[model samples]
Target: MPTFTAAAHGGPVKTVLVGRAHNELVYHGDVLNTTARIQAQCNALGSQLLISEVLYQQLEPQPAGQFARRGQLVLRDKA
Candidate 1:
């Protein structure tokens, strides 16, 4: 999974996946959360294995959407 940078109020964190990158790992995260009722409604279907949008876009010879659509991850807005 491509680790995307997140700019916290203090500064940018190298490991925090945010924006499009966070979207990539979320499907994996869903593996655990899917058992609970609430997460199923909010996350991608358990079958949609995905990579980061940046890499997916660079995936040439094939269309990017083969893996996942751009900006498909539904992240809760930061408070």
Candidate 2:
């Protein structure tokens, strides 16, 4: 098995949805549970570490459509 290094742990999953509050990956007293599903999926996959899209956004945060997806990274060497 290959170990994937995730860089998205403990990041914000904020949204513009009405009647909701800003939320981060780790649950807190005030943060919404927007990232619960994704967190659960990662846990189920045995991925203790995660990459945070919000961290990337720290460079250039977008107004809308800020999203990130994960997949099994395949290594292929062509000789």
Candidate 3:
């Protein structure tokens, strides 16, 4: 069985070119870091997909019982 993990967050991010060649596009910011932390929880949670609260709130409302709450997750560097 193949397992997959995903996380989402809606916010501003800083993108810039990095590396010695200055040809690589890198994305950084609190939002990205938070998303990474959320993605890291997938294995432990045994879930195929994980969506952050920020993204969830931005999304259109869904039918009742369409999504289940996974409870709060304490992420690194997050107050």
Report lDDT per candidate.
Answer: 0.36, 0.43, 0.87
For candidate 2, write residues 1-79 as lDDT tens digits: 9654332334444444343464433434211332343444564556755444544446565556544456633212211
Candidate 3 lDDT for residue 14: 90
The runs of at least 3 residues in candidate 3 whose Cα sits more than 4 Å from the true structure, single-residue gaps closed, are 19-22
- Models 1 onward score TM values of 0.28, 0.28, 0.81
Candidate with best TM-score: 3
Minimal lDDT window, size 10, model 3: 1-10
- Which residue segments of model 2 deviate by more than 4 Å? 1-31, 59-79
TM-score of 3: 0.81
Candidate 1 has its poorest 10 consecutive residues by lDDT at 4-13
Q: How well does model 1 score by local distance difference test? A: 0.36
**Residue range 1-79, candidate 3, lDDT tens digits:** 8756798877899999999999999888889889989999888888878888888998899999877889999998789
- Tell me the alpha-carbon RMSD of every candidate: 13.7, 13.4, 1.9
Q: Which residue pairs in candidate 3 collide? A: none
Question: Once model 1 is optimally superposed onto the true structure by TM-score, how far is the C-alpha of residue 5 displaced, in angstroms?
Answer: 22
Candidate 2 yields a Cα-based lDDT of 0.43
User: Residue 1: error of model 3 in Å?
Assistant: 5.4
